[model samples]
Target: MPCVKIDMIKGVRSPDEIKHLAEVVQEVFLDKFAAPNRDRYQVITQHEPYELIFEDTGLNIPRTEKLVFIQIFQQGRSADQKRALYASLAERLEKDCGVPGSDLVISCNRNEKEDWSFGYGRAQFLEGDL
Candidate 1:
C-alpha cells in the first residue's frame, strides 16, 4: 500500500480538477505499484502561492504556479517499478491532468509493514487484519 500526498498552490485548479488529478495518480499507482483496488490512501493539500517554493535544481526546467509535488510512502518496490511509475505519472498527468512533467516532482519513501496502523489503535499489518 502507498499513502500519497499531493501538494499544490491554491486556486491553480478547480475542485473537479483536483479530484481528477488525484484519480489519475491513483490509476498510476494501481498500474505501476500494484496497489489494491481499495487501497487508495491519498491527501490533496492546496496551499497559498506564498506557501510553496520550488526550484529547478540546475535542470533548467521551468517552474510555475501549477507545480505539483507528490510524495509516496510505502513498502518495498523495485527500482524498475519506480521508473515505470515516474514515466507513467509524467505522461498520464500531462495527458489527463494538464500537469507538465517539468512541473511535477515525485518522491518515494520506503517503509515496513509495521509502520502502518489502519485503525483501532492497532497495528493491523502485524495483527494480520490487512
Candidate 2:
C-alpha cells in the first residue's frame, strides 16, 4: 500500500484536479510497486497558499514561488523502483496538472507492517476496507 500526502498552495487547483492527482499517485503505486487491487491506499491533499511557506533554511532565504511536496509511504518497495516511479510521476504530473517536474519534490519512505493500524488497532487488512 502507498499512502501519499500532497501539500501545495491554496486555490491552486479545483477538486477535480486534486482527484486527478490522487489518481496519478495511485497509478504510480500500482504500476511501480505492483500493488494489488485489494491493497488499501490513502492520499490526503492540503492546499495552503497564504500560510504555506517555502524557504531554504540552510541559506536563510525564502523561495519566491510555491512548491509541491509529495510524501509517499510504501511497505516494501526498492530504491530502484522509487527512482523510476518518481521520473514517471513527474512527467505525468507535468502533463496532467501543469505542475513542472522541477517544482515537484517527492519523498519516498518505507513503512513496516507493524507501523500501520487499519482498524481497531489491527495490523491485518480488513476485507471491506481493502
Instruction: Encode model 2's per-residue lDDT on 51-112: one tens digit a residue.
Output: 65555557644343336778888777878899989998888888877777667778888877
- Can you write out model 1's per-residue Cα lDDT over 1-130, one digit (the tens) per residue? 9999999999999999999999999999999999999999999999999888888889999988889999999898999999999999999999999998999999999999889989888999999888
Which candidate ranks first by TM-score, i.e. highest?
1
| Candidate 2 ranges beyond 4 A from true positions | 55-66, 125-130
Candidate 1, which ten residues in sequence have the lowest lDDT sum?
Answer: 49-58
**lDDT for predicted candidate 1 compared with the true structure:** 0.95
Backbone collision count in every prediction? 0, 1
Q: Candidate 1, clashing residue pairs? A: none
On lDDT, the candidate that comes out on top is 1
The superposed Cα distance between candidate 1 and the true structure at residue 115, in angstroms, equals 0.8
